[model samples]
Target: MDGRHSRISVLMFPWLAHGHISPFLELAKKLTKRNFHIYFCSTPVNLRPIKEKLPEKYSLSIQLVELHLPSLPELPPHYHTTNGLPPHLMPTLKKAFDMASPNFSTIVKNLRPDLLIYDFLQQWAPSIALSRNIPAVEFLPTNAAMTSFVIHLTKNPGVEFPFPEIYLRDNYAISKFQNVLESSANGIKDTERAVECCEQSSEIVLIKTFREIEAKYLDYLSELTGKKIVPVGPLVQDPVHEYDEKPGIMEWLNNKERSSTVFVSFGSEYFLSKEEMEEIAYGLEQSMVPFIWVVRFPGGAKVSLEMALPKGFLDRVGDGGMVVEGWAPQTKILEHSSIGGFSSHCGWSSVLESMKLGVPIIAMPMHLDQPINARLVEEVGMGLEVERDMNGKLKREEVAKVIREVVVEKAGESVRQKAKELKEKLISKGEEEIDEVVQEVVQLCRKKNRH
Candidate 1:
């Protein structure tokens, strides 16, 4: 081994979604800045898009490790969009992890790295790293509040509440729900076994969130784990692309009154059904707010919008609205002056970006950690959740109500002010702190090597 070399391997099971992959990749880039060699592993299918976006300077240091899985049968007719994985694929992913563990073990042995950092879903990582005497850390792309909640749930089992229900309960009750979800999901049951694997093997749990923002919950988790819990985050930054400026939206925003526009994006991963799309469109039109709605084209099993939107919906909105299909420059859009509020699926990266921009949120959490994020945002008095019935179908009126609450009500102003304050705090810390976090990780790895 080259004693002076700062090398670490990062394994990520991307699970066919950009939301999961992007933050992990960002963390890898951050580590690269600290002179660490990163072995970025993913499925062959996910490599293509990442390759297109990666800058030339860092390309050599980031190595791609590809794993091939037998293609399962096509997704069911009703649910094939990017919003979520097919239910059957969960077991398939578990099986694939089991199959890949030995292969990953061989890679680690050959590379002989000092540390292994992996995503929450990679069940084999902790075991493989531990067997080789390397320290393993779990990188959660979700908010710290959710991480604290999950960790709490894992320690104290048996709490029953959906995300919204939990939020309605008192602050302490919310804490209990967090613990319940974590323990139930990562407890003695089938799902909890993987978390058990991580807890047993890992030396530390590294989360991507700020300690100042979620201090109470972080303290709770630190007490429960009896291990160091580090919060190294707001891990996302605006990608420096060379494309021409898309300032047209800003000009349109200036024409409108302040806080008049509602920005609707379900992130790159979630897709709306034709029926759901129509409902959203009609609801937006009914609400009479100037808006920007971003939607992706027919990819996977999503319905095309050639005939789905209400008749003359585009014409009626005219300069008042814009529909950006495919990729929209999200950071710039959120930073615009006239853009008043966000309607989001509560992806952590998006949540952080919105918080940094001081935009109030209309959170419509779809799956995974989203519901938990929604609860945190609302709890902090910065946002409101659009109520969803037990069936998971969102009504148009409810959408309208939440949008009005966030965009038109006095409560939203407090949320927006708090969000801006948080953003300023992050900025005051500067980019140098980000470098320090990555350096600390490298230092930890080097410490492991000496032993």
Candidate 2:
């Protein structure tokens, strides 16, 4: 308390997924601006890319710390991260993570930071922090609507979600979500882990959302959790320095008309099945809209793009499409003048990015909170969800119809206008939310010192 102007130190621990680590890094960058020193912790495999992405200026304020997970038989050092991990090894990865609790405790003891900001899962993190008298808070990168929806189900079982607009009406989605909630790693269910993490937070829970889009959901979540829900303002990545990664795509986009092209990507972790990819390709071809579609395969997957896609699809679409494999500059592309709509898997981070960049979404929610997110997208009037058939299969015609309606049709004007309005609203708000966040965090640190 003596050095009042001294910078506060925080250690950020997100889950192994790229989606989780990304927002945490964005939040760390924001905190560094307000006189906060961040210790970004993760596995070595995950840290490598982060190190490359970090600019030279942040070398002092932001330091990377590696937490080594014990290598099991099938889980090697490289497999410690979930970026390109095989689906079946998920449980093993979680087991390895849990086993690393002792190593984390060692790091915590050595660093001895004022506060710990951890992601969902790993309730053990806060327990260790508490033992050492360090205040710990949970930072969920997921949106408020989905977070509230899951917590509601966990706390009040057998009750219907109050908001009818957001639901898993698709039986396939419902079954998958149930599996996710009931699924266990190291003898703890996922939902139970989430609930416990929220309960263990010192007083406040930080979420990656803004009040303009989810005021009611945030309020409802606060009521449900009995803790203040702090919206951290979307936490979208800054695209200023990411332009050099894919110049050809940017050059192609420059030639397109304003608000005429769609950018398609699922996410880093989830690889689309062959059938799913084929359907989307046909749909895109039918729509006649210029698009830049990014395709990804799992680690050790040798399937070529030619094999995965329909025959002659590449030559047929020729100049109208750009089929990029591996990765693209998502934020950079979304912010471009040519990208009007996004054909996305509706992952929470992607959803926030689209809204922040003022690009309307052609939501094709695949699984696990995506359907609910898609529903919220339509509810807020910022996007339209593509309709699927009875068995929850994506139809080519419906996909084409929604793509046309969202991007190139007269009916989509309202959606496009709404996207721009939301973007302006977010821009005007600027750093107001982060200012409030700083106050709340400082108060927590002070209270701990007083105790």
Q: Which candidate leads in TM-score?
A: 2
* Model 2 residue 127 CA deviation in Å: 0.5
Q: What is candidate 2's TM-score against the reference?
A: 0.97
Q: What are the C-alpha RMSDs, in order, of all predicted structures? A: 5.0, 1.8
Provide the global lDDT of candidate 2 against the true structure. Answer: 0.91
Tens-place lDDT per residue, model 1, 1-451, is 1224444555443434567678778777777766677777766667766788788877887877765543445533222113355544545555554556677777777776666777666556677777777777776666656665555555565663223323432343344344444432212343365356447535556666776667776676667666566677777666455436555656666788877899999877666777678778877877787898887644555544546677888988778788877767888778877788899988888888887778888887766677777878887666888876545567788888778878877756777777778778877765553554565566667777788
The CA-based lDDT of model 1 is what? 0.67
Best by lDDT: 2
Which stretch of 10 consecutive residues in model 2 shows the poorest summed lDDT? 1-10
Taking all chains together, the TM-score of candidate 1 against the true structure is 0.83
Q: How far is candidate 1 from the true structure (C-alpha RMSD, Å)?
A: 5.0
